[model samples]
Target: MKERNILDILGNAEEDTMEFLTEKCPEITDAELDALIDATEKKYKTKKKAKDGTEKDNNINMTENEVSGVEHSRRPAWLAPLLTAASIVLTAGVVLGSVMLLNRHGHNGGGIEQPAVTATTTSVTAAVSTIATSAGTATGTAAMSTATTQTVTAAETTAETTVYTTVPFVAPAAEKLYVDNELGSIALELFKKDDEVRYYPMGGGIECDIHDGIKFAADPELDIWCIDYSVEGDSYPAVHDIAYYCHVTDSKFSSLEEIKNYARRTMSENRYEQFFGGKMAKDIDNLEYMDTIDKEHTKFWIEYRGKLYELAYVGGWGKLPSVFSDFYPVIIADKTDTSYTAYIPLWYIQVEDINNCICVELKLILDPEFNDWRVDNVEQFDGKHYEELYNMLKG
Candidate 1:
């Protein structure tokens, strides 16, 4: 074709597109467009060369020339140095972003861990404070209770100590109590001093004058009631039998010395210093004697009898296991106290068939029934028995 004719079509014709640059561009030329295409081709060659390396190198060189072109358009300087600086800043930003991301992840993880640690610490501290407070309160209450107990114990001890220090008063030791009789004579407080004038060893009731010569008792165990004698309806004396329990304030008691002197004047003043003769008396270990001699078991005895039936005597009765004497009276020097002077009888009288004291014993065994009791027969008494045991003195 004609080159001038092709140039004419190049200005505004598609037919000139396939034609090699016929002449040169009039305004914008085809040579410049081809130079741009060559530069793009060189950048593509660099991208292809980076495909053999790591992903970082591939990504860095993939658009390195393209990035340099962008920089070249902004400022006309050494684009390679500018590209290096931008790459360094981008690398620093990537590193800074990674650090920030790691820091954010650490903060989120630490947030999860902190709440649990704080809750546990707070709970432990609260438990420790509660335990400490409880222990302190318990210790304080225990100390206070101990102090209160000690104070109460001390007060009780002091009160007990003060109660037992003082003693009661007493009457003099040389007086006597007497009663008026219907026969117009005065009868003194009389106690039979015969140590050997009883039917039972530890048990014997009192024997008063029934008429002229005979004497007897209804209840023989409780002898304290017999001391109060009445002259047939002169106020009717309280004690009518051997087992009668007498009143304390109703009867007057002489002083201890006066009682001993009066007993000596009214009764026998001597004691038996020898043993008796009999088959059973020779060997006194027999239990048969224990049954007959128990004052708590028997009814009555023939007074002033001469034979020693080991069952029949006086003095060794009441709470004491063993004692002697016919007189069992509660002497009242000071009526309220057992520690005062008591005229405790210490001998038994053996009454034989006759009305006389036959045998004397210094000591006699009391019945087991007498433990913690004052046996009195007034509750079940029959006055008809007075005539049965009588071995009277017939004038």
Candidate 2:
């Protein structure tokens, strides 16, 4: 049978409202219909009782209302009752539809809110479907079930089995850093959120593996993360640069001073000062507390400008000098509550010609000693892996 337009019927005659509803949802028994009507009427009375006197005053002084006179004149006295019935029916449809949608999304483990209608038996499936269709929610069988009881049970099960949580991790940021030197043009950046930081090696341009390498090390006792980098000889032709990571725990000395202290403690003070070109201080700022530490961290790099003097001529054109740069930022590919992945793109320019980029990917875990991140795994991939890495970060 062709469906009757419920709104048009409501406007045409209030007497046909029950007949219209029965034809639309024949599964609704007389007892259920009576219960729905009684519930809706009680709710309407409660709302009416809670209202202020202003609405009553406006009803008496209708002339002061902002609505046009013609519209107000056409409103039927029985329209309120028809609207109340329609609202009740629509609310029931919404409840059922929401349960179906949640079930489809694998959230069917918890009990869903039942419709206001109190069915005597579990066979109100057809009635629920018809009402849902009337309220524009019965789109397809994928979400809607023939058995309303089954659908409700599935949703309830989902609620019982699923646990939702918020995991703490730093999300990557939008800021970028660009490097265009004798090496090549490249972009890199880092993101900071709260106490965590994430890095992006390829920021402004297409995501590619270009920076030589990015190394991350956490301070033993602090939240500080020290970054080290290695640039290939292909970048500058004669130099394969690298900078070792460093961290300072003592506030008395700078990062440089901490490095110097390590060198002094590792070797004889005179030998260390001769290589570093500085005298050891008398204060014993950091070395007194430490027994042994890596002296390489104390190494520093300088630009060394001007012409090459005759007596200071340096030789060996066969192998490039594997020296460290001043500093390079680290890239964060992915992050989690206790772990993260960082990346460094490795690309070199030979005679001003650009080459395909490769990347070093590092997986890091939180070390219990200092609550610091430690490298757990490392992998290398070409630009072809960019899509996969990008998806990993997004996922």
Candidate 3:
């Protein structure tokens, strides 16, 4: 779904919005989760303390009023503070629930949310055309059962089983794919998702072995999944690109309006510097180049002025350098979150990193083999936060 429409669905404010973030980002570990929770708790405590002060003032008012000859009576002043605390608690729970859903459904943190989805028993129709075994010794009667109760294992159980029997119910079947190319063909997939082999068929007589590999590292909840698709090679035109995104709850998508509001409010208040109180780009123009990446699985960053602005995108582990350090705002002032390599029609760019500028690289959503417009920087792995995640998720 187009992210623009997701704004209504993505609710990012309303406290504990990171729940949606957790849903969208798969690589977050237990430590990260702890960090997030701790951070949130601290924030809540701070808010509660300030709000409690308001209650104290009201308590003083009621006490003074009761002592005076004002004929009116009122409830305890502490009541409002108690109620506000309760309200905050209730709101936090609801927001947490929404965020969990977003993570499970793989919602995009770029303020897009979808409904939480679980792998229910989808009635996958197996178009079985009885393959007539040519050998005479293969006389067998088979029963094809479409059983819903049949336990399905994701990686544990696969469609590539091999235990033949009179009732050959096992599988080694291929997945079905139906591409709806109306939006726009993804520029990256050097090897189409359905390509028989990990190679590309170019127009000329030349064929390229492009391992459009995408590997995922997901949280145990399986709420969201992210894939890496950086490429490897020595020179520019010989490199690769990457991207991916998983599922997320619809409610999560609806929740991001809060963050947008917060950003706008920060801008309006002119107190964003006081609020965030740290080094983040204060002006939108700082990263205006973000709009350039209009395709899936691509990112556009802004940095560097006179020289080259290194915009980058990648696929596969070998191409990690081009996408990570090479595109970092510090190294080149061009960067993207590595989790974004697999999101098709890539959109989302970090204008500044650590609040600084460097080089800029043009990130191509599906460009393989960087020509004049492309360059390759293939490295096995750089121990990026995302890389650590993919490692933990490997089957």
Candidate 4:
């Protein structure tokens, strides 16, 4: 038998002849079979058109079956590709059927048994459908890439906030003393004396006669006093005056020299000049004058503003009939007037015979221009005398 090409078998051979070609060419693929079928159909149509004497322009007027010798069917022009693919499938089916039958008859006993033609054709058709689906997926993926190229933006903004703080109020030193009731009471009670001898207001004249043969005479103009009394039956007379005393005792200086040393050490040259009026050492030295009390006891005094003021007692006694007790000094600053004042408590002897004691008040004043406070005024009173004057000074 002569070896025949697959295209020649498809062009003019009948079904029996195609089966014979498939039996001869067992390795012919489905793709080669589909190409052979397409070429045979084109050749058959061209021969048929020439046999009917139909011109190429007149072929368009012919019905589907009349042009191809098949059943007439209406289809869209876009389905041309589908129709061509279907023809390829049909040709592949024919080749598969031939291969299946040859295997059933055992003509090639040594060859592997082939799958059924319907199964093979179904698998080929599925492969074609899968390729079409994969192409559609690739197109969808391209569209997705275009859609994925997008961006987001945010706007810039600003905010502002404010905060406030509170400040506490502090009262001035002078105003604090006047307004605070507790502080005023403490100031007033500082000089209050215990009741033993009562105070009596004098009228008409300074002549007053009291018990123990004591005579009291007062100079109302200067608030001075002259007292005559007998001590151990010995007649004696003394003159006294109400005067401001230095109030630095609260600093707890061990001695007068310490006090003077502190002033000298702490005060600047200008401050020393302003305070002592250029009489720092000399005046302070001269101010240390002392009066003898029968050689065994003595009384010390400091002269200021042309008057003699005695030293407050820490623990001592004297002949002038003065108080012997501890004195505590208090300093107060008045910022409203830029001034400072010090109150010195003068614990004085109450009665010459009993040794009872009371406090006499002394005040020192300092202005901003002065570095040291100057003894300014004094108030002497008891549980009885000068109550109104004490209250006025208290305020």
Candidate 5:
């Protein structure tokens, strides 16, 4: 009989036979069988003496040695491949069994039932699903982050673009007053109640109602006076309707002499000289000074070059310069209170030639809180005491 290769025998074996062979000799392989055959041939060529003084073939001992050598050398090399082949066989068997079972129960040749997936395929599918889910979560988180950033940016932009408007101011109705003997005794008595101010003569005179529009400060040591007043009506940009009333008053001295003496004490020599010798002196020359027993307040006005000009003086403080057109006669009225100075520039057309020249009238408003003023929708008058003057000037 022709010799058959062991690999061929295994390949052609029936399933039952192969299983039986595998169970009986699990470690046997074609290389191991070849080693056994080689050992047998060597054993036959070399005889050994047996215990009975007879020569014997050591084929069985040689076969045992060959089997041990093969196990030591090849066992380590074959283990991974054997495991991999066994796994492939097991997976294939499982798939084949499932397909066979499905085919048996499936509709006759019209439809085939899908085979159950193997463990490896199922594991791979599960891994892919997990990766897909993770990607989706990452995408959602990125989108949410972008949306939040946009919302915050939009809110910041709105804040930047929003404009703030100013608020209007209301006057105080009453304030406190201080009296000093050095400034000379005045018969007027002042007091405040609920937001209203009332004054009357200590020695019986006309009663007067006033607002907290006036403020007064005097230094007997320096013989200086600082008075602040607030005015009603519209003002120019950064300008307030207030006036700074400052001067010195002495009952024993004449008004002009007292003003000259104060100027000498407070002003530079040049300034004092310039004031008396300049246009101010000429303007003073044209003014008419009048006093009344009912109100000790002095009033000054002048009709100059067909225009009427006025001096504004209140309380015991001296006069402030005028800024309205000379053509418009202005009467000094109740002055308001403030802490800082404000300026309003008044433009007037010359009466001589209405189109020839434009004059600027710079008026000062003194308010303590000048810096705190905010521009709002409030109307400002040219001067609080100038309604009659305005009418006359207009005429």
Candidate 6:
């Protein structure tokens, strides 16, 4: 590239004057030169403000060069100083414009075209306006940046909340039923037949042989249904019986508080506080006890009658395992909009006589109060003396 002399292009100016201007100013590109010429013309020509603040065109044409071929007798007295000031102003403008361009586009330039100032200004103004609105700040760019971050965080949180709220409630699968004891989440194997569902905690549903099963005696006054089974002899007139005294009723509970109250009201005796671990009784009367009791497991209690000749209470009973509680691993056997059938394990008796889990089948109706279900009926199965039936000789 050749360095073009400024005096060669401005032959009408004095040689010393041209040399001074070129030495003090940087080499302007064609685009910058055109901008400088236009700015100078606009400032000194076509409009001038009068002392009375009225505008009128001065008709002053300041950029006539040697290329125009318009010769003057002599230059005006103020022309030299005016041209000196214009050259200095143009040099400053060029330097400022280049810095702005490099800051925006970067220093790596092969032949990058400079962006128009008006277009850049408009874009920047619009962006600043948007930031100012969001940040509630008229002029602080730092506030705008902070506000943008907060807005994005809020949007993400709302999206997560929306997804959580939109997801429908799904009942856990039968295999997923678990009891959270000292050891966390002990899985229960589910065995269901019709409405009768059982969860094997010891996983011996197949090994436990039911010689006789499902003899039911109902006490309607107490809303109690007693189911007895025997593994030693027959289900009816059994030698050793495993009895489950289930207190079943058509009851509506608006909340768990009501259910707790019902549990307190319907106990065989006034041992609800002791059994549920509220305020302990002053006397040491031990019908049944728990090692640990909390809201998760102490919601209800089941009386497991170990020895019973008939529906008459022989008084041999204790608190069933916490795994059998209604607040424990209850399997939703069947569910619908208006009603559902829940299979709650009442007791698991594994003794010398019998090894079986007594599960009660309950049909619950939906109530409108708290969208909770109430016990509609307790479905009872009749006694089956399998061992006695098998022992009959062939005729």
> Residue 374 error for model 5, in Å?
41
Per-model CA lDDT versus the true structure: 0.21, 0.28, 0.24, 0.27, 0.22, 0.26
Off by over 4 Å in 2: 1-257, 260-335, 344-346, 349-355, 372-378, 391-395
Give the lDDT of residue 334 in candidate 6: 48
Q: What is the RMSD of candidate 4?
A: 62.4
Candidate 4 lDDT, tens digit per residue, 1-395?
Answer: 12233334457668665444333222222322333344446544555544344333334346756565244444445445544655564555465445534432333211111111110111011121110111111110000000011111222111111000011112224333322243323333322221100000000001112111211221223322122222222222222321112222223233444434444343333333322221111133222222211211111223333332222111100011233322222323242342332232222222321112222333333433445433332333232222222333466
CA lDDT, candidate 5, residue 154? 51
Q: Write the per-residue lDDT of candidate 1 for residues 140-195, one digit (tens) a residue.
A: 00000000001124554455421111111122233321111311110012212332
lDDT of 3 at 179: 23
Which order, best to worst by lDDT? 2, 4, 6, 3, 5, 1
What TM-score would you give candidate 5 relative to the actual structure? Answer: 0.12
What's the true lDDT of residue 385 in model 2?
Answer: 42
State the weakest 10-residue window (summed lDDT) of model 3.
Answer: 196-205
Please, what are the lDDT tens digits per residue for candidate 6 over residues 50-156?
21122113233346563322343344455556656556555544543443333333221111111111100100110111100121111111100000001124555
Candidate that scores best on TM-score: 3
Minimum summed lDDT over a 10-residue window in model 4 is located at: 139-148
Worst 10 residues of 6 by lDDT: 141-150
lDDT of 5 by residue, 205-237 (tens): 111111111222211222111111122322111
Residues 1-395 of candidate 2 have per-residue lDDT tens digits of: 12233234445645344332222221222222333444445555554543433344345334555543322233344555655755665565454333333333332111111122211111123133221111111111101111112233555445432110111122344232222331121112211110010000000101112232222221222211111112233211111021221121123334344444434332233323333332111222233212222222212211112110000000000101111122332345345577655654433211111123334444555555446444343333443343334444445
lDDT of 6 at 391: 22
Per-model TM values vs. the true structure: 0.12, 0.18, 0.21, 0.17, 0.12, 0.17
lDDT of 4: 0.27
Ranking 2 against 3 by lDDT, winner: 2
Q: What lDDT score goes with residue 388 in model 5? A: 24
